[model samples]
Target: MARSSTPFSLHRLAVALVSCGLGLHAAAQSANPSDSPPSSTALPGVVVKGASEAPLSVGGFGDTPIAKLPLQASIVSAERMTDRGLISLAGLTSLDASVGDSYNSAGYVSYLKVRGFDLDNRFNYRRDGLPINAEAAISLSNKGSLEVLKGTSGIQAGTSAPGGLVNLVVKRPTLELTSVTLAVSERGTIDTAMDWSRRFSDGHGNDKAFGLRVNVEAAKLRPELRDADGNRWLLSAAGDWRVSRDTLVEAEVELSRQSQPSQPGFSLLGSTLPDAKSIDPRINLNNQSWSQPVVFEGKTASLRVTHQLNADWKLQAHGAIQRLVNDDRLAYPFGCTASDGTYYASSYCPDGTFDQYDFRSENEHRDTDALDLSAQGKLDIGGMRHDLSTGVLFSRFRSRLQGQAYNFAGTGNIWGTLPTVADPSLTGTNTDRTERSTEFYLRDAVQLSERWQGWLGLRHTRLHRESWQVNAAPGAEQPTRYSQSLTTPWLGASYAIDPQLMAYGSWGEGVQSDVAPNRAEYVNKGRALPALRSKQWEFGLKSGSRSVDWSINYFDIRQAAARDVDAGGGLVERVLDGTQHHRGIEAQADLKWTGGGVVASAMKLRARIEGSSDASLNGLKPANVPETTLKLQAHQNAFLTGLELQAGLVYEGKRMVLPDNSVAIPGWTRLDLGAKYEQNVGRQLLIWRVGVDNVTDRRAWRESPYQYGHAYLYPLANRTWRASVEWVL
Candidate 1:
């Protein structure tokens, strides 16, 4: 294990969080009513600011705004989070049409697929442009904003799925402020949080300045699923120092823990799609008396420094580290166990009988490190002006596992009484995995003319990976090692037709490593395969207007694909197949009026297999991706003095369950409604927010994902209601 350069203790963090929360709560209560000033409320996600073109950090297009960049991007501010009552990625991702769930379950860490590709949790998520592990439960209480780059991001992030990049920016210290929130839900869940911040100045100007912000939260989590409940706690702190007029330093640390039993998804009965309406979301197929809640504990810290070299040049250094662990214990229900003790393809018996197992996976550790040094500047080369950004980054990830147990317990009936289970105390298989990469990147923005612009970039990366058997005997088989190097390229051009309209085109290529899963079906399992490459082309038109803003983009992506192949009677081997081609059109439009606004996003995609090793595999659509997705969210200030009304709509087209297209999950649509009210009581500002999800109580199969040659189905959540109260001091 690598030692930490900066010491961090969860004990210290918890103590400090308690102390701060107590002190602030007392101060809020002790404030004299007669001395308090008047209070007022402002609409969330609505702000007035100057007209400045801010760069999309996730795109790595220095000095270029989203309108000028060749790709579409979205930024969700903190205020928007409050207005929408979105607290998890599951909620936030629903606002966009290009994203969908992949093997997501009720209490487990969620997984997502962007543009028809599963986003690698280890490489697709970042914190302030620094790589961080996302396998653990990520807390949003201390995030200032969320940025999503909608297309290929080879120029900024390396070796990632074409699904784009997700970045979390830490919240910084604002003016002196204190706020507390208390919330409850229909399922009897309770949540409370406190946010406190202050800024200190030793001189009038840049002589000396410092700022600090702290956030603490606790929750008793209760989901609609029966017998699957847990608790959560989080603590985070951020600080910044203005050393001089041209230089600044920022740092942040956070710790969070969650304990919730993971819910098992329903499955098909031997290639037969089950009626979603007949399945209840509250059913506890995995609820055994011996089951224990899954627990996840995570800690992360980051530091950044920025310096101004001159009027048009700047330098920056950033470093981030994350450590995470998960303990899983559950009575997992998987494939049906036949009378002969052989597992079958059916998730449940034809008569509704299923076998349960003491599925256990514990003592897993995942650690990550990311460091970068970059420079950005504007210069005149020959006759044309250019904006350039160059950077070098190093990323490393390590994982260690203690063992697992998948021993069968007993057979149970889905509708009848469930059988009791016991722990088998099976031995575990210990393993370790590590990956390291170093990359050098450079990007240039060239001014072709006043109305035309061009962008070019290239990145070179070298990666090394190793997998080990921790308990291998002496002179056993050697550990697996692999290395590769590649160069990725990006090109883009844009033409401004008018102040509010622009046309743009871009192309990029990226590479990703593939490793076959370690399973009993594959002959050559647990081995690394050749690196796969992918390319994308996109064209779009965007409009920026005061009353209306919109964009429409057409994109085509081609990627190398791989899948498990039946080698012979009972064994299988993973083979590198031909290619997967996806052609799609996506659009986003925003409309604003007096006291109301509407944001709409939609996508139409057609994904198919182009060339494959097996002749039968050609022309088949990939499983689990929706061909059509639409989302709409709107809010209006009601005629009532302090009330606002909100609505959301989601529609998804039918998705195939198997590559052969034999079974297809039916299409589904859902509706949501919400309202908020603000009022002043005495001298304090108070706000109340309430909302209901799945208002129609639609019982639908949200997604169907295939793994280990077995099909699994996940269902949508039941209709739920939540309400929260906020007090600002």
Candidate 2:
């Protein structure tokens, strides 16, 4: 683990500052009743000054809650994130429906999934308004908050997979100073974080706006899956300056480093093991564990810029570059050896043959480059108003995997010694694949009258993919593959039932054509690439007041051209004329009690997957999706004398592992409790907090890493305890 070189913990300070700032700001702003503008209520939902674009919320897609999106959307907040003791991005999928977790082939390193969709794809990720994905696993682990939008959101998120997209919102610096937290848990785990934010802006003085935020975090965890362990160190900073009153520029940057040792598999996909209490020797959990014999490391660096143009118009540009290095080789373990000289029940490879497996040793890396520019503004014409937003996005995603394989002819042990391996000349299987996607889109929300509203959106996307494979042998001609193109459309409508409620519906089409001249296209000869689209129906009531807020929604979503493989082992996933229906009900309510000091928030959700026979996924239980889910929370801070107290609870329903419909899992419930106290030390002050997680030690299985047949449950952490103390400066 890299040692922290920073002066203090930034994360702790940032969180405390941001939380307090927002809370106090809201209170202060509400108290000043005379500071109301022309459109007071409308501006509340439009805190993101300058312009409104697409009616899509940056915190989550659309104005609805995660559970109320036209499709199922689940949101995990930063506060819940830390309280749940999440260690990696995979941890966020625990309560989500149809989302799975995987420990990737490299081991220890994990990835998340929703309905078997490759959500880690770059296009599916977004921070604020910027889009990105982790080329390496480390980036996924350090995220602060995540919102998983289930089903196709191509109309809003642009070109991408059809299953779902996880939009991770990173933590930012705030105007708070001095915050700290420390924790120790089972498995010799330890973590510490600190954050501090200082504002030079003058709301109390000369009005010269300036602020700086710094965050630092580090942790060490020994996972239960295997003998492997991981360590991470992170540092991030942000600064903002106001150029006069109409223009402002803010720059943000982050750096992180992570390293972990090799470990065995913790989850399984399909296993023939018997369901006995204490039986089945062949069902060993580590039977399929593949180890990487070398150590691994990953690093990331990013910079973002935001500028405000005017109160109703603004232009922003953002660019980021990243490099990923995996310095290790996969080694087949001896434990996987079968007594009869066979590996598992799969006949793909006999006892110790090389061609049957993709095991190899080598260095692999990927470079990511992205630049996105967009403008958003609002135009109000008398009683008629137009909330318009437009933007262009360009991204380059590239990866290179070059390594050596042993025992090509199945004749040698091919151990530590570097063997001649394959004729490296034939470019057996090494390539640099680069994909670039450019998109231009515009969306306008037109309010024609007091009760009627309409939205029009259009997006044109062009995807170009290129790959070059070079062989190590002399005169080996390298191979290159390239392809380009796709377009999408969107529309929506809403009707106001009263001052506090509204009902709306939307329809959109998303497209993704294979941009490469792969075997599928070459074999079919320009017959066109695979494409998928979604037709969605939604209706809901949104209404609320200062003391109570609530919303309810019902929706049906159908997808076309879903991907599915054929018996010939070919890309048989074609555009089948089939419809898969996902219908659900969701509602959220928050009540403020105890003299406006205590608040109670609760959410209920239920979802299902119904597929048509024509889609080849007829009865398959929509992979990694849960059939039902529910959550309830109650948070309150009461001041009695000089101390404050707080408490909360969370629950999750049962989930499924695969789309095969062969297995079912039970539900799990977890509880969290915490409290804080504060006092004065001369002119300075001190605040203390303590909390406990998983008070029940429930044996919960995380649906992620569902590949292996093991009971792949993400067991609740054994009653973790934490304590923190901060000084208000």
Candidate 3:
């Protein structure tokens, strides 16, 4: 079926854009330029907006505070990501209740799922109010913080999975004079980061100024076991030149590279027997692995121009480019081996002795490039208190994938080890595929009244895909091109109940289109798959005192029109009329005392697939989603010395992945501790910190799918401790 429901979807999109543009013009003309001077010292709305870490910056969406965005939204600050030593996107999402193991596949690649909906990079990301869900992996560096918007984000970040959206805020040059951090952790790891900013003003009648800000971070990340050695380094620089008091130009760039060995992916099986750790732990299978030897790189650069048209109106135009490349290999056992010599295709292993009979050796390579451009501006309506903001975003993404695989069968039972294969020519084959997408969107945030706010958004997106198999028989035809298009809309509202409390609710819709046309499904039926879409609703409360703050929220999300399966074990090539939903609550609190402070957060989630006939698919707990998760922390400054004591505890409830509802797994909890001291001797500065992760040495397991449907678990990184000293100039 066609993705658009309305006969005039394209026309409607045009009208929406025109209406927002007209409203913006009115606001700009009516606003008075003398309302507030454009100066850092001015404690006006602009300064307040800039200082507060709201969800309006790049990689951020939804104005709902971290506590009230969604009962399930999880906010991980820069301090927290570093404290947990989670430097990768996958690591950041692992602990998120909304994005569990369902997206954490065996490969290091990161996928996000919120509210039971899949959120791939294609159309579900934002960076500084810019669309960044391009074809390439969005590399992040010198980030100030991160926010995960729970539920469908059609209003905040159009065309995405209902599961959620992750926004990353980059560090910007500010008036803040200085800040520094240095630390060392488990297994002799070290990290140091610094921030510097300065402003220069022209003495002429023209109020012109220039600012330079630079943030640098370097760290050596070493794994606990042998054969795992890796390092992470980042450099971020941003400079802005205010040509005139009303205009400014800015530029920034980021670079990062990572290299490491592949960890093991062991299957998790459920069984009726009490002694069974897995459904079939005894059925030992061959371990397959792959890794990027040394070269894995990602890069990004952007340029922007900001102009102030008048007191009520301002505009910004931004453009950027990004590129990413990776080369890797995979070695896996395709099936089980018999005691004698032959190979069989099943999970079971015959006889007490195991053997490796079936295997596939393969290599993979990928390259992606993307381009983005957008214009955003804010205006105030004349004679009205309404402040209107509108913008249009355009982006293009392209990707290339090429690979070859070989099979070795009948290689006698050499279980748990690599098997020797004969016949080189018959063992290998190759294939190639390419995908591209183009998206355009316009959104408006309307301040309806002093106590109420509303937002309206619309978007249009198109996707094209093609694939070919080079090793096929001469007469076989390569796949032809396939195309699809979709249009989406969003609505939201917010209200202030009192000085210390506010309540808000939003309903947003998003879509995920197929990478290619379902040729098989087309041949079997008359129509192609419709774009998958999801809807979300959320409400919450916020309250705080002079030294303490807290927030709570409740959310519900639903997804429909998803991929179904057929007899051949391949995607059914058709959309299934099914629904998936999640309901949950989230809470957080921060407190400060005369000499000490505390921070705490907790989550409770319950998700289910509402309508599916398969017993295993019906009501089965969503994979990797813990029913309860909590984190508590306390730190104190020495009353008589220059020392600090810190302690934290984390708890995770049981999680399971099963097709049948009959089998399940239990939950676990863990604790950690640390201490640090600082001192100064002459011209040098010295600081030391010592801590242990998983102090109790608990054998924690994280739900993972190294192979589709074949549950795998990642063991806790292991109990580790380290200490370090630093100096300042």
Candidate 4:
């Protein structure tokens, strides 16, 4: 069973650090000149790998060591991704205790919750600081790193979910290299990819140079669920031109497509919870023999220009554009009904019977474009030194739906025969939504005294949205529009009591765009609600050394929560009547030896609804939010001379399924194992890797979420294995 995990002693350790000598700053600044940040004109990697550990740096935050900053963040390097086969967000959940699956399904866009709140797909994702729709799976083959900023720092993103921000750093051209990989899964999945990169010098003593990097991949995926197969392919290229020693230009383009039939999860058996152990994880609950797959097509491109304004300052401008199209087709299983065709309020009936719908939504387009301009460098006035970064961003997002169809097919049983129904007519031009926003941000890292440093940032944003139900208002006079503005501020302070240990605390606020459910039971269904505001504050202590690095964090996050309630009539309306408060403490430690490394993390969270109108819901834990989680990732080199061993453990605590705390799901633990072998033949290097997921074959529900007014129980995948061969050419 799953039990909540915590590190209660962390507070005592923090107190000791404060009372003793370590209060504000952890990692010592790099002394080697080579460890300095890359020139703004040069498009180099984020981290410098050497004998000693180097802190991460990116465009938005300048060259500061993120670990020493007051904010919370995590980095997944490209090497780790390739070694661990972490191509999707689902794989990341096993290593990060605070990340959770939030109604995410196969063959569709990934959804996640950080801490205890859901992330918005439209605003919570970024491509090198510019925004992009995470509505499609980003191909990791062309990515250099993934950065998760754990709070809505207005300096990073103008407006976004309070949960977190996910940034994808695409691969940039580098030294000459070529690699090819072929991978396969035990369940008949196959994948192949090729990566090539090289720099073409001007040959005039390196006055100018052009670098190019290309990635291509294809996959035939066989999912764990029956009839839920998929196929995917991607082609991406990134280039950089060092125009001069003080100027550089970079560009990237990505085109990809994925098609897979989504598998719907199981639901409660009508007022009774089914034993998760009794159900087979591979059963087909939402598929028929003949069905089309949910298709996703994406194209994205970006360009950036950077110049050194002077010896003390740098300026950069970046622009990006993206378009995503989805064709959703499914024979989805839904609510249950009596044998005599009587309607029920929930999913499955007592006898395991439920209704099915042939849902088809096609030609859904999401388009986004953004431009960013910033200057960051050292500044001095009178007798104070400041690391100041100022920027402005303009962005627009548009969503259009061209066709949709949702009609009842017939009755079906989980353990019996399923009915087949004819296709329904498709409607046209159903929805059109556009969002435009502009933001100006400023951040100043001040050197206050020798031991005390502070970071103060602010962002002012103006947003306008227009939504139209074209079907309901054909040839109408105008679309419903709303305009709003918000100014968010961020503050942080760090005291470097010593070089190895630092104490830091930060407070920030963010905004989220919430929408009422599209269900017909409510009066204001399918309407946009007002902007929701969220607040978060945390304090932490961290220490870094040659052999080890560790941090302990405590956070309190509060957000306005939406709920469905009876509005006196028979129908229910969605309302924001309460607040969701989450308080948690997390600890992480990383140790690296000569031939091995280990990462261990744990989170203890108490998330509940407060000040609710419904007495039953007050102080109740929200659905799908786990109380505790534990994760460990480890790798050992030289296990047998040129062989490496890898392992991971994930433990999730018990979680509630209903808002009223009427039902709950047990917690579970899973282990993963893998190995890698490397060999050098003549002039080429070859690597072989094999891994097994869910090695224990535990049968348990991974998540129980109430989405769109319905309950879904997503089961954990059974034991599966994968093997791959990589050749460095």
Task: Per model, state how many residue pairs clash.
Answer: 0, 29, 16, 7
TM-scores for every predicted model: 0.90, 0.73, 0.77, 0.91
Residues 515-567, model 3: lDDT tens digits: 43324443333243566677666666554433444555566666764434564
In candidate 4, what are the lDDT values of residues 1-729, reduced to their tens digit? 333333345456446644432321222234323456668786653442431144444325576766577877777888778777776766668778888888877766788888978888888888888899887766788888887777565556766878788888899998989999999985789999999999896787783399999999999989677777889999999999998889999999999999888878788888777887888888766666556788989999999999998998999999999999988888777887787777655557777878887788888899999999989899887677899989889999999886567777777777536766746567433668899999999989898878888889898898887776655535642356767788888898999867666779989888776566544577877667776778888998776665566677888888887777887668878888888888887777776666888888778888877888886677788889998899998999964788999999999998888777788899999999999999888999999999998998999999998876577788888998889999998
Task: Give the range where candidate 1 is weakest over 10 consecutive residues by summed lDDT.
Answer: 3-12
RMSD of each: 12.0, 11.1, 10.1, 5.4
Q: Higher TM-score: candidate 1 or 3? A: 1
lDDT per model vs. reference: 0.79, 0.51, 0.54, 0.79
Tens digits of lDDT, candidate 1, 234-261: 9999999988889999999999998988
| Residue ranges of candidate 4 with Cα displaced over 4 Å | 1-59, 340-342, 415-417, 427-429, 473-478, 515-530, 570-574
Give the candidates in order of TM-score, highest first.
4, 1, 3, 2
The whole-model C-alpha lDDT of candidate 4 against the native structure comes to 0.79
Candidate 2: give its CA RMSD in angstroms: 11.1
Query: Residue 515 in model 1: shift from native, Å?
Result: 3.2
| TM-score (C-alpha, index-matched) for candidate 3 | 0.77
Model 3 per-residue lDDT at 482? 66
Per-residue error (Å), model 2, residue 311: 4.5
